[model samples]
Target: MEARERVVKMGALKHHSIVRRILTLVVSMVILIALVNSAVINTMIYRQLLTEYKSKGIAISQSIADSASDILLFRDPATIQSLLDQHLTINGVAYLVLEDAENNIVAHTFVPQVPQALRTIYAGKRTTTATTAFHRLPGLGNVYEISQPILFGEIGIIHVGMSLKPIHHSMLKVVAILIPILLVVLITALFVFRSRLRFVTRPLVELADYTKHLAGHNFEQSLPEQGAIRAIAAEHNDEVGRLSETIVSLEDAIMTYIGDLKRTTAAKQKIESELMIARQIQLGMLPKSTDNTAFETVKIASYLEPAREVGGDFFDFINVGEDVYIVAGDVSGKGVSAAIFMATTMMLIKAKAQEHIPPQELMVSVNNQLIALNENMLFVTVFCGKINRYTGIFSYVNAGHPAPFIKRKNEALEIPLTGGMALGVDYHHYYQQRELQLENNDTICLYTDGISEAMDVAQNQYTEARLAQCIGQSKAVSAHELMDDILQDVRIFSDGADQSDDITVLLASWCHASASVSSELGVHFTNDLSEIAKLHQVVDIYSQANGLTKTLQHNLKLVLEELIANTISYGYRDHEIHDIKVFFTVVNNALNMRIEDDGIPFNPLEDAPEVDHSLSLEDMPVGGLGIHIVKNFVDTIHYERQDHLNVVEFTKSLGETA
Candidate 1:
């Protein structure tokens, strides 16, 4: 039992010794790691400070050289010496020297009591020296000896020896500064490292806890993905940069996905609202059927096709007793603003029609209204007319509007009328009225510019000539049939092209007349004396048809003779050959005659010489009195120059005097 007890004691002692040795080894290893880390950090700080000191020293040296040269040039020795003394007082600038050409120091500023051996060694050097010598100096810790040779003209060399007192003082001051700084850095690093280690380890611990929690079906807390834990795992390189970029990309993708959903929902709502408004506005702009039955024998058919969600086309019909007013207009541009303008135009036309205003007067009012409200310079093209339904007389006005096609018994003719500028361009514009006598079963077709300007896939317009031909062929069809044929033909020509603007059409036919009086006469005359007899025939036709009084016939005969003689003499004066065309149409108890010439733009009203009527015929300056006689007897005369054709129309309203 005693030997067993001793063996146990020995075993316990050996175990204790082994534990103490392991503890000592661990402690020594910890001290070594700490010492190595401190040495590395200190070396980095020392190198940084040394680099700063070297740069400062070089800068100071260059500055001193520049200052000395400036003083020598200016011959200012006091300023040079003062600058040297100031440099010596600054920290880290151990010494400063300004020497003359002779081997004598001109200005030397140094700390007192430099070492003797170092001074002797510096003095012995023959050539200019640049070396840092270490020495012991009085009242200064370790010192550096820097020597340089200075030359000023042809004198002997001047040696400059300066003790590096400021440098030593700066080094001692650095040590003093470093003691507290190092202490703070050490304490801060210790706390920071502890915090960082915890920061790194805490996330790992949390991840482990999360795994444990997940095993228990609990996913309440999330792991922190950034900071120290991420730094350790990321390991700074391309991998870290890529991981950061990937996370940012994923975040952006999530944000974009959410935004897309919101935008889709809002867009759907907006489209629905727009469609509803378009349906309401479209239904409201159409003419009501209750007002159509007031006319005695007037037929009206219209079609409005909207290209998009809204249209800019509009048409209206208003009947007042025996008269009927019709309007077809298109506002420029499209969408909501155009729709608003269309509504305003419709209301203005309706209001003016209700006042029994003539088509030309109504157009002038509308133009003035548009110009007043037109801050954006928006204009509308309108073709407006008033039909004396009982008399079968069609009076119309065009405001830069496309001409309507008239399906006569024999031909489809565009109404030959002058149009003014578009509405909203100028308030002073005047639209002229034109009258046409429509017989029974004659159809008048009016349309918007969209029909003529419609383009095919290849961008070819459905031209006006093609439209005229189409109407001429379909004159026998019903109003509805005519509209359908024209619209279908336009669509076929367009060849599946996108509808760019609104398409609108209005067709009206006169089915009866109270007193069908036709005074249609044609005369062909040239600038020749032999064709003068046709003018008598023209006056005779008008006199017999209207049963004109004897005095009116004489006046008409005199005006016709004077106009014919003027054209035969002076119209073809410059050209060798020229044909004159005269057309006469009496509608609504008014006789209208148009005279066309290919001659130059000369207005008889303007160019006709004023006659001193008191002079004798031979003394009358021969050419002036003829046009003056025609102007005095005519009710109204107007001139227009279009292309190369000069047209003058004379209106003799039989209702005015006969």
Candidate 2:
């Protein structure tokens, strides 16, 4: 109510101010017009009155001159005086005079005597037309003094005085009449105009108040119909009504927009939550970094940062028999869909690489799988390679991916590409494999375009030349340090600019290291019961040398005994001797083991029987107990058939549980 009152007061103030200004302007104009009209009327009346008085004075003087001409010829003063008196009775004729031929006044009608001022007239001077002159006589006031000739100046002239008092009196009377009429008209117009103005301005004032009310209130709610707003809208059929209607419609639109915005905001929040979860899942799909000591011949490190909650770039590295397989890929777009595609591609690449697929073959296979599954026609660029630790030979394939830098003895050089299209574009696209022999301590840096194309505030890109320069300038001694140096340099170059794409970097450095009791342990023995003791002896020596926990050693002994005993019993159909190669390494508090045996094909990861916890111990399966116990003791396991050999690899974290 208080707000409404304020609005009303404001509207009233505005209305009154406008009305008062308009009234003041109009009244001033009316008064000025009236004064001008009165001036014009007075001028016209004065002109008409002066002309009439002069005409009347001229006639009276002429009549007296003619009458006195005969009267003076007989020398009759009585008749001449009578004629002068008779003409004096005419209005505006102040006085009349008659003179003899000898300039003697024959008859005159002044107050008591004719003033001397008029007596100076010379009758000797004649005029063909009657002439008049104005003068202020001593007794008579202002008058037009007319001198008339009598019979061509043979007789004396007649002097007639026409007073100007009638013109003054007539002007005064006109003013009196005009002033009253003007006042009456002005008063009437003012009253009518003020009344009509109130009628017109009242609605406008209400509209202003209602508009102010609308501005103060929330527009999300429907406008009330029982107020000044409604009154003005219903009562008027003009611009005011249309304006009110438009305002109401605007409020409705605002309400709808606010509702939709709320829904959209909630939906967006939900999608963001889902995307965050998906980001975690996508990150989980990438390979976890292992300790540098895990591989005796290569040190590996990787860095990945998505531009958004989820991104399209991915990297993976895994041990492939005697070689280290590494891959880096980038999808075409960013966000959730790209992340999904990236996860799919990474899984495919890892699975194919684990199967001992070559770099070029893996690209062809993963590309076909992606093409069959890609409904959005999205594609991914990949650079995959296999580094042979024993031979220092690096074989790689580039599928429309950026070239990697090879840092050899402090010199950074780009590895030339064996051209191939990005995956998922054409299923028939062929990819070529290129080989480069790696030297000891040589670092290979693989990265996505995000590193090279990073922009600064000036829109300058951190190009490939910059990457090579950064790599060349780096004083890092290991793959992890070099990777960090490259990433840091890129960030410094970007200088707080927005990241436009996902960034990924993978580095691998090759070096020679002997297999010793400190870092690694390996042995080769026949699948004979006597040689199982040799495996135990080697594991015991390596554990004691490396300070491994007793529980880890026990778990390792139990798993190896179970797997090798099963292999000797069931893995071979022939009784001939079969050799098994066993290697162990302690990397970052975890024990990594690789087993290769030239026996019948067996994949312990999949061929292992399922252990049912629901069954009693006596009812439990018999053939799968060894594999089940091995799985329970180990953290991870991978099995593959490579070159007719069953290779089983597993890692056990050095935690209390084993």
Candidate 3:
């Protein structure tokens, strides 16, 4: 039964409207013909049987009427009985009866039995015209009667009745004939319908299965259109063929797109890699380190940070005998092209520096070189200077660059060297230079515009005023210390905004010979107090050998005391005993001392608290005044914290006036 249900469902899935219509027409025609034939057959058979019965009744009534007239005229009851017996002998006749006027029975016939009740009913009513009776006999079946008037001057009434057994038998025979014919028609229709449905539905079932596989992304299968199914395919040419063609086209397009994307990605990666290499080469062009102690009293500290892959800011320093040349410049643009032009400008400056020319002459030569190679119309703003370390004089040329600051003693001021267009403007342009004196403890700071033009997170520029203020506050620090402090301050102000350009600072200080003697002393000590006493003994030997003055002796003693106390106290804050070394030198009659310690770095000079002179001695802080007094007596001091050693140097002139 389950298999039969599945077959029926499969037939429904594949059934076509045309085949369904034909099956419906066949079934309807068969049912309509059966209904019409059954109705006509029943109607004709009933009418024929009723007519025959009426005719038989008429004939029997006429015969009985004649017999009744004879009986009444001749009074022969035997004749009537004979007539009734004759009629009863015929087939399907059950009984016969006759009644006269006044309800008196004339004659009666019974075949194998008639009920006494029927006889009584016949005797109860009488008429002069015809009368009829019907009865069911026990062995003779249904009966019919007919009667007629005697009409011998209306002497008596006559009636006749007969059976209808033949009509019932005929109806049963008709039903027996029609039932087998209907069964044969129904059986033939079932076989014929199954065969036709197979022809129509088999190809459709195959097509449905193929479509299911295709929906699951399996495009490799194809359908065979043949026979009756091919006729359907020929009608509309099959939508499945169009779908397969579209899939092929889409696959081709996807492959082409993927190939193009891969090629484009490779090309982009190659370009990016080349740009990185170019950036590295640009960085490699800058100077690494300067010649050590190359100039008498000059130091330069520079910093460069590019905002992008490359930059255009540069600085160069050259020493020519008694004079040192310094150049700090910024090109007009940024990136690789600007970096190329900056390199060219540095080469020109180097050539000019070696020629022993004045700053104005050097700028004129460098400008000619730049303008000759200025096909791209590139330009650079530069501040170039040539300083005489021996005379403490500087001659500089400014070409649209920010003015350099000069810290002379306690006063910090900007140099007034102004005039000349930037390089690459005109080939034969004249450059001007201004000369100024650098006093003792004076600092000449040369820088690029990147310093003063650096911006903070708020987009505010680190203006020249702020730069000057930072420089003034750090005047007591050495050249390197001052530069470090300024960079730290700028970084704090900028708050992680990129250093937009190069930062280059060069500081030069002049120390006279007479002021150098009061500063030079050296000592060495151990963890033992005897070793410290021995260090004092060695210092006395050197002071006596050099014939030092009382004031010089007092200053040297104080400097040594501070140096030893710092090494013994905070330098070994973990209480680890260590050795210390000190060296003294006199260059051109100026005293210089160098002290070294194998302890943690602690620079008393830098960390010293500022003294509030307004407060009285009783109210004054006692801890920081030691380094302050040491600084007041010395002309110049420098400290370096190198691996496991703190090196501090002190310098002063020997003359009483210093």
Candidate 4:
């Protein structure tokens, strides 16, 4: 009985194999015929519909042009509307419009307004004959538009649009009917022939099940091969047989790959851990928060954010005697390589800064050192400056960096770029030095391109112009507050965009110590004699608040009035108005005053005449009396011509206010 059952099974498989091939051939031919028939039918119907619609549109437009000529001459919109309505009722007529030669619509058969796309038909050059083209209206779908010029477009024009939506509907209907027929034939063929072929497919199913089982494990050893899968792999040499053999081999390959992956993952994790430690170490290399006690009158604030685990922007401050060296630099590129280059540049800067050399000389030294060590050809843009904390003189050098901003009073001005190249590019490149005079409460802002070139989602940058405006608005605030506000503004402009580069900002403010609660006062006025009274009022108020004696107040008022009167009277060569600025600071029972004016250069110490005791007041020259009084009232005075302005500074030691 068992032998008989085996014979029957083999015979059934043989019969079904023949049936499968015949059914497959019949199904392939049916699908190919259906596809070819649908494509050919759709193309023929679309072309026929387009040609018919275009012809109908052109015929209607020409008829309207013939009938509307009288209406165009009479300028009768009602008759033109009647003519358009008559033609719009025709089949597939989407819209009809009548317009004079000026392209102004006189009549349109539309529920609302005609589509603006139709206007271009006549809006172009005048069409002597009937012209036709295709267009897609907003609500009307595809359309065949035709235009006819009446009396060579001098009198008027007629437009007609025929809808092409019917062609699309016909094509869809053909596909819908043919697809179901193809599916029915395929289903019948599969059910009749494929159902009997399960005898041949059972072995394949067993191989698939064995493969899935093998995939679920780490494959500590080769899986026990199933009998059915072994039979297919060994007994037959067809596609199924080859697939079974490949799966058996794949089990061993997967086990080897898993071991390698585990080792690679562990190694990657160790590398990441090391990188994290390196990031912390790199951060520790940066200078700490400045101790206010160390930098007596100068307030410094800095902010740094890296685009990755490490970045390339750095800033440093080093004090040497009475001067402080400020450095801000950016190494090209980003990530670990840039961070290493940045670290190198920073170390070189510190080494050179210890020498207390001028900014330009220091830059030259650092540039040469970096070039020697630069194997990757990396470069850095640096801005280095030295500021005399007491004298308020800042000498700076730019090395292909963005110009820093100076916030004096309520204005933010960008220092002009000095012609220099970035470091490590060329050893012989010479750097130029520039100087600025910082007064009380003035701020210097240093930054990298990250802040200025920060981009929003739409790629708009936080430009330098906007940065200047922000600084100007945040004027008079402390360095810490200003830095916070600037960072906040940058955040708002970026609007959650991913940061692409490192960001660093440094703000240094000059806030000289003063005895009074109000540290300093700066006043601006034109060169007018009447401005003296305002000066007196200011001097009196300030001196009184600071507990100055009546004698000291009188002397202060007298000295300022004398110097200002001399300047307003003789400093100008023309009657045009000129501005004068005065700044006052009091510290330890002493008054410091600085006067600046853009007038003819005059140094009171050199230009003033000598007052000799032998010469009477009447014998003395007229110009020297006022200056001699000023010189006597102030204990120490200095004058210089800088930036085309006369700068006169004086300090008076008022002995304890009694």
Best by TM-score: 2
Query: What shift in Å separates residue 266 of candidate 3 from its native position after superposition?
Result: 5.0
The TM-score values for the models, in the order shown, are 0.41, 0.57, 0.43, 0.44
Candidate 2 lDDT tens digits, 1-658: 8867877888899999989998999999999999899899999998898888878887788777777778888988888888888888888888887766677777799767777777775435556467888888766688887888888778778888888888888999999999999999999999999998887788778667666766776655765742566666777788877776676677678778888997899999999999899988888887667545335567889888999999999998877666789899999999988998999999999889888878989899999999999999999999999998666799999999999998887899898999999999998788999998988788899999999999998999999999999999899988888888999999899999999889999998887433225656677768787667655755665666566788877888889988888888788889898888888887777888999998899887678878888999889766778898999999998998999899999998876533
Span of 10 residues, lowest total lDDT, candidate 1? 152-161
Best by lDDT: 2
Misplaced by over 4 Å in model 1 are: 1-252, 264-272, 275-279, 288-296, 513-658
How accurate locally, in lDDT, is each candidate?
A: 0.68, 0.84, 0.69, 0.81
Give per-residue CA lDDT, model 3, range 1-658, as digits (tens).
Answer: 5754565566555565646676778777877887788668967896788678767767776776775676766757788778877887766555666555555665677543446766566564545556565666556666665656667326565555566767777876886788678758866985688676665455556445434433443222233322333454444344643443444444445556656777798898887677678667765765544423224355555556666666788777787656778788889888778888988998889888888899999999999989989899999999898877556688899998888787665556988966889988888889999898766666677777788888887789998888888887775545566667678888888999877766555555544323322334444466444455445544554565576777886787777776677567667666556778878787767778888887776777778887888998798886876788888888889989888888888886777533
Arranged by lDDT with the best first, the candidates are 2, 4, 3, 1
Q: Model 1, range 434-522, lDDT digits (tens) per residue?
A: 89898787778898878988899999999888888888887445667777788988989998999888888888877663222236655
TM-score, candidate number 1? 0.41
Off by over 4 Å in 3: 1-278, 289-294, 408-411, 498-658
Model 2 residue 210 CA deviation (Å) reads 6.1
| Model 4 agreement with the true structure over 331-426: per-residue lDDT tens digits | 999888899999999999988888889999999989999999999999999999988766678899999999999888778889778888999999
- Report per-prediction Cα RMSD to one decimal: 32.1, 13.4, 17.5, 37.0
lDDT score of model 4? Answer: 0.81
Residue 79 accuracy (lDDT) in model 3: 82
